[model samples]
Target: MNEITVSLPDGSKRSLAAGATILDLAASIGTGLAKAAIAGKVDGNLVDLQTPLADGATVEIVTEKSPDALHIIRHSTSHLMAQAVKQLFPQAKVTIGPAIETGFYYDFDLEKSFSPEDLEKIEAKMRELAKADLKIEREVLSSADAIELFRTMGEDYKVELIQDLGAESVSLYRQGDFVDLCRGPHLPRTSLCKAFKLTSLAGAYWRGDEKRAMLQRVYGTAFADKKELEAYLARIEEAKKRDHRKLGRELDLFSFNDEVGAGLVIWHPKGAMLRTILEDFERREHLKRGYDIVLGPQILKTELWQRSGHYENYRENMYFTTIDEQGYGIKPMNCLSHMMIYKSQLRSYRDLPLRFFELGTVHRHERAGVLHGLLRVRGFTQDDAHILCTPDQLDAEIKGVLSFVRDVMGIFGFDYEMELSTRPEKSIGSDEDWERATSALLSALKDSGREFEINEGDGAFYGPKIDIKLRDALDRRWQCATIQCDFTLPERFELTYVDADGEKKRPVMVHRVILGAIERFIGVLIEHFAGNFPTWLAPVQATIVTVTDNQIPYAETAFNTLRAAGVRVQKDFRNEKLGFKIREAQLQKIPYMLVVGDKEVEAGLVAPRFRDGKNLESMTPEQFIAFIQDEVKSYR
Candidate 1:
């Protein structure tokens, strides 16, 4: 008998036959583990339980306790959904199914659309199939044979996918009567996908091309157990209530119309005020940190973009215009202009670490289907900055950016996590440059003592980056800040600084955004605070209400006093009931309300009430101004 040595993660070894499978190994260790195992990791790569072991290979059983288990379950559930859909509607042709961050979705081409009831039927069928516990089997077939088989079943979409793969052979998974072409590590049986539900349905173009056939995409989610699924559904409900778009309309912050075109935001008066407050804070903060403010033209000549590599790598997402036979490209990034500034004059090692800041608005050619409120927009302003530093200063500059992100996010009361994204498949620059850049970011993150995850192949086209996603009150994560380290752009533009040895060397660049996009940050803030902004950021910080017509004079005086003190104040001098005015103010999400009545007028004081229904003791105009200033300062 041929024997193999299997190395465990804990440095233990087990002697087994070379042909033994992961399932066999698990059963040998413990029956409980064998039952819990969904898959196995052979030398760090996920594989199915039935995968045969090799000599001296390290193996780890992947169970429900594994971090990757949910993704695997969700992916397997997507396939089960396709199978169920096929069983219910034989006319439907499945295109692709994949697991997403939220859950899973499968696109299908059918003559008729799927109604809500159809989703129910498909879910019910999935449950039935799970109960049947059908064994899922895998096979490898020649591309020709696979295409012929799918073609025989009238699955033109599958045939097209297989033909496009351009591989000699393909992997296929079959469970009972349904089979799918996939490179998979699916659950051994359908029973593992029991705790799942069909979420919603939408229309997606085949291959995302408008000219291609439009397919119906069915979204769903699966969990390890029923309780987990229920918890996720509860979060979904809460997310709906905290949706920024709903709050934006309710609070009259901003709007978008067909007349203004999609993905373009028209800020209302209150929204503009909110943005103004944020911008003022941003400018002051940047100045305090020794950053020099800068501005760039909206559209630069196309030749400049080509020189910066944006034309080659990012042209698809950029807007280009031809003016009087001359070509120009609207800037999708602020880094280009910052780079030109660096090259404008001779820089020495002593003048290194130049930080340039900009509140620059940029336009992107985002697809219409993906645009949503202020979160995903065509035009948005970024709290963007770029730093040029020598190689020796790279680590410190990265740490400075991290500190800036921490402080800004703290001010916003946002709990965030960092992700170090490595070089992407389509990115430029040499391996050595990417390696150096990634190392600097990693070292900075470690030195900061902040926990960060690695997101492979999700960096910018020119460099590796650290993406900071903030967690809202509802625990939903939003990507709002990023710190990117680039070595390619400087090289592309031939940027150099005289070193201590009097030799010119390429300088490193750091492209970072503290608040990502102004519009998106506002959207996140709206949801985070549930439209009830804090005193500092509130559009209407305080509202002065007169209890009676006689108190109008005092209310006017109070409003004027607060306004002169730099508070965003509003006045309600109508003959409406006092309670009605207060209720309206509370509904408008003002942080404070000053009530002026007979007693307040006589004492030359104002009664302050919080939007939370807490009343403070009466204070004179001077005292009230001092109190509000203290509170605002505390927030800053």
Candidate 2:
């Protein structure tokens, strides 16, 4: 037999038959590996265990420990589901099945509508197929032969897909009696898919085109280990309990009225109070940092946006209106408005970096399917700002923004990960300009000593950008801070300043938002702290519960004093048991509960209890006030 050298993960080489499969290599190594092997990586591309080896090639057997093996398993599970569908509904035409973020989905076009009963039947068939432990086999054929096979098999979607294949051959996989048109790196046998569950079913347009066939898509999730699968299901249950939409209703935070609009969120009293507190804290911080607050209009002439290039690229997301027979658009970004402000005045090198800030509410029309609570809503307020400066001033401006982002995130006790997104394929500006902007962004992140990954070809059309993701209490990451560099917007809008050289040059624009959207950030805050906001930020911070009617007078006095001190105090003087009143306050997650009884009243003292059930000894009312004040001050 012809022999070939296979490179192993340990930097060692092994000689084997040139046409050998990955299973053969694993068997040579040990039974343990052969049993554990799920697939193979040949020259870095995932493939089946039966692939013929290339001479002097790299090979690594993928096992449960391999990171990408989960995706391989999910892909295979999707195929298995499709196979089950085909087995049950022989007339069901399979289209495409792909691995998703946390699951897999397969689309099928069937004459009859599928119901919950059908899902149960499909799942039972899947388990039956899994128990068979049938070997998964692969076949490669010429393009013409593959097309003919799909055509003969009555898979029109597969035939349509094969027409686009410019390659000489295509691969197909089969297990038991069900064969599929796929390029798979599937498990060796059906038994390897130990745990999986069908999640849901939805209607999707073929290729997302409504004109095409409406396909029924079945979604499912798979895992390598059963314990992890159970844990994931448990987390999903916990997430459902903590969902902001449901929590918002239970907490009376906000509401969306269909009569008003789809994406417009109306903050209720409690929510508005929270917003005010958050905004107040941010305003004070900005003022101390020498940031100049400015205002901009909600509507601008379409000509202005055209100059800013928003009309060309982002117009689809913008809301356009006609006024005075001229087209106008509701702003989707604050950068354009700030740019117009900078252009309104002349500046010299002495005024190098000008930071103009706004809590701008902007409108962007999003698809109906993508909206989820406040997290993905349209028409939201952004804590947005723009800095116009020269290349010499870029570093300091970046440092300032970084420091602000860090301080803000730090306030919430948020730990963050960073990503630097570079230019996209269809972006504006010269190649040289794009390179410089990307370099500036990367340098800022490096200088700050922040670890970041590069997201290639994911930047905004005008410039490269830096994005910050904060891991919440659930360990779920949410992208909240964005720092972008824009050269094209300034040039397009003819925004410039005079340098020491006495010549006019376009100023570079830096758009940054520390807290992306007030609504989304507030929603995140709800989940992060489980609705127990910090003392200063809480809508109702302290509740004074009286032990009896005699103590009610003292509670009222104490509440009055606390309110005058701006402590967010409330009086709970209802004729009820002290324990019941305390329980009510705790349920609301109020940061503090002050208990007043006749003995404490006579002693001019009170008992302090933190919302988390920590207690303090009886203290003078004056001491209690001082302690709560100190806690609030420390929060700032």
Judged by lDDT, which candidate is best? 1
Clashes of each: 0, 0
Candidate 1 per-residue lDDT over residues 371-466, each given as its tens digit: 989999999999999999999999999998899889989998999999999988888889999999999999999998978999999999999999
The segments of candidate 2 whose C-alpha lies over 4 angstroms from its true place after superposition are 89-91, 110-121, 142-156, 163-169, 201-203, 210-216, 547-551, 576-580
TM-score each candidate.
0.94, 0.92
The candidate that wins on TM-score is 1
Q: Write the per-residue lDDT of candidate 2 for residues 1-636, one digit (tens) a residue.
A: 589888998899988987888988888899999988888998889988887888888999999889889998889889888989999999999999998877899999998898988988988888888888989989889989989988998999998887887778998888987888888878888878878888788988888886888899998899998897898788777777778888788778899999988988999988899999988887888888877899899999999888776787788899999988999999998887787788788888788688898999999998775677889899898888899999888878888899998998888989999999999986788888898899999999999997899999999989999999999877888989999998777777777788888998878889999898988899899888878888878998888888888887777887887788777877888899888988888877788898998888988887889988999898876787788788888966
Question: Candidate 1: which stretches are off by over 4 Å?
Answer: 430-432, 496-505
lDDT of 1 at 373: 90
* Candidate 1: residue pairs that collide: none
- Tell me how far the alpha carbon of residue 489 in candidate 1 is from the true structure, in angstroms, after superposition: 3.0
Q: What's the lDDT of the predicted structure labeled candidate 2?
A: 0.87
lDDT of 1 at 364: 94
RMSD of each: 2.2, 2.6
Error of 2 at 144 (Å): 4.9
Relative to the true structure, candidate 2 reaches a TM of: 0.92
lDDT of 1 at 473: 91
